[model samples]
Every structure is written in C-alpha cells, then in structure tokens.
Target: MTTHCDFGASLNDYLRDRLVSGIRSESAKQKLLSEASLTFEQATKIVLSMEQAEKSAAALSIGRPERIHQMSSVVARRGRFDNGAQHSKTHSQTARSDNAGAAWRGAGGTAKV
Candidate 1:
C-alpha cells in the first residue's frame, strides 16, 4: 500500500532538486511549490499528478500512446464514485486452511476420503 505523504514528499524533493540543480531555476521551483501550497493536501496531489504525468509522457515518448490512454481510462474509472471492485469469495473459501476439514490420505492418485 502506498501513502500519499511518503511518495508525495519523495516526489516533492525530487522535482525540487532536479529543477534546482539541473535547471538552476529558483523561480520555477518557487512557482510550483507556491501553487501546490494552497491547501494541506494540495502538495501531495500535485506531486502525484506530476508523477503520473511523467509516466504518461514516457509512455508516449516510447510510441505507446494507446497504453497511456488505456491506463488513464482505468485510473479515471477507479476515480469514479464507487467501490464496487472487490475480491470475490464464498463463505467456505474464507475458512483458514489449517482449521478446515481434512484432506484424503493418498499413496497414489487413488485415496480414501
């Protein structure tokens, strides 16, 4: 499971460092940081958006526009107002294997149940 804060802080550091060292642009870094500082969660969201944008950019650069679009659609669908995607299982399937009914003892393919 990924946390918004963990990856967000990492990304924030990354983009800031890259822009500062690689481009030597204080204005750009300040602008980005300021824009993302409007709310408490804005920074994390901006970081996540930048990460995803870079991923899509890489995919397009590699000539896989369809894959980027497909992945985007999946994200959009998952972002919709629903939690219907779930792991399916029956009641019996939920039992712990160690505590369940015993299996047949077999010397070969044939065995007594």
Candidate 2:
C-alpha cells in the first residue's frame, strides 16, 4: 500500500522547517509570518522601509568623507589580496597568512604606542 501526502500541508511544513532553522529570533519569525499575511502593497512597503533603515545605518556607521574613502581603500586592498591569492602559485601560504592576519587584527594587533 502507498501513502499519499497533501501538497499544501507538505509545503507549509517545509516552510516552517526552513523558518525555524534560518531565523534565530522568535519575534522576527512571527513578524515574517504576519507580514506574509499582508496584501502585496503593504508587504512591499514594509520591506522597503526595513531595507532603507539598514542602508541608513550602514551609511552612518561608515561615517564622514575622509573616513569613508579610507574604508573603501581598505576594502579594495583586501579584495585585491583575495584575488591575487586565488591566482598565486603559493596559494596555501598566502591563505594561511591571511587567516593569521585576520585573527591578529580581531585581537587588536598588539597595540603599539
């Protein structure tokens, strides 16, 4: 004998499993479910607002002109380093040093006076 499953129920169960695994915050999960119940326009506006807030925060954190330029330069340098290592003959050494540098930077780099 073969068992049959309800597709709608199966889909809902799959979505619930993904939500539980992907979202660490109970409040966020509930908010997502509630938003899913909204009309398309309302949901679109809510998502846009959330995205705008995130963009604003990122812009604020990166701060003023000079600092923003410096941050961009650092990001560019890291990207070049990453790309160069991808093409280098001694890729393992470069990768190891990159990991060590990241750890050291995270530890505050032995602060010099």
Candidate 3:
C-alpha cells in the first residue's frame, strides 16, 4: 500500500510523538532492548533522546541560518602562511647523540621488524 500525508505540526514533533507511542508498546520495548543491546530502562532513555534530537534538528533546519548565527557566537581561527620565511632554531636544541636533547626528531635506532 502507498500513502502520503503531512502533519499539521513540525516534522520533528510528529516524529517525537510517534516515538513516544511506539516506546509505550511491549514489542517496541523488547525490540529496542535486543537490537540496541540496552536494558528496558536504557531503551526508554534512548527513545526519548532520539525524539528530542529529531525535534532539535527540525527546529534548526526550518529556521534561517543567518538568524541562528545572531543568536550564538562562533569563533574561528586562520593561520598566516609565509612561503619565504625560515624558522630559527634555538642554540641549545641541537641534535644530541643520546637522543635525549632532541624532542621532535625520530631516534635513528634499529626497529625489530
């Protein structure tokens, strides 16, 4: 059978309501527990969490991204890349025979493999 229908409420709200109804069923509870490797208590929590996450996703998707940006602060970092610059090494950090003084270099030692 084929069917098409739209909910009067948001998609997330509809999904959440459906999840609540399914979670109330014994078969749904057992399936959730076995499939998800969860206890009855955990199944209930997981169902509720999925419902809430869908609701939040729907809320975010339906709203304009720009308006949401104004509601929160976002910080980003960008580094300056200098093609011609050479990094100076400190005098005391020269490579040592014992490999103790050098931090970043691979110890030129034999591998068992």
Please list the C-alpha lDDT of all candidates, in the order they appear.
0.56, 0.62, 0.54
Residue-wise C-alpha lDDT for candidate 2, range 1-113, written one tens digit per residue:
11365565355556454544575556544555675454435544555566677789888877487887888998887884464455644888888777888887877995222
Q: How well does each candidate superpose onto the true structure, as a TM-score?
A: 0.28, 0.29, 0.28
lDDT of 1 by residue, 1-113 (tens): 34445676566566555544453345444545567334435544655666677789887689577788997898798875547776667766755442233332233443343
Candidate 1 Cα deviation (angstroms), residue 48? 0.4
Whole-model lDDT, model 2: 0.62
| Better candidate by TM-score, 1 or 3 | 3
| Prediction 1 global C-alpha lDDT | 0.56
Q: Candidate 2, residue 71: CA error in Å?
A: 19
Q: Enumerate clash totals for all models, in the order shown.
A: 0, 0, 0
Residue 18 C-alpha lDDT in model 3? 52
Tens digit per residue, CA lDDT, model 3, 36-78: 4344455557777766877898887886787667544332122
Model 3 score (lDDT): 0.54
- By lDDT, the best candidate is 2
Tally clashing residue pairs in candidate 1.
0
Which consecutive 10 residues in model 1 have the weakest lDDT in total?
98-107
Q: Is candidate 1 or candidate 3 better by lDDT?
A: 1
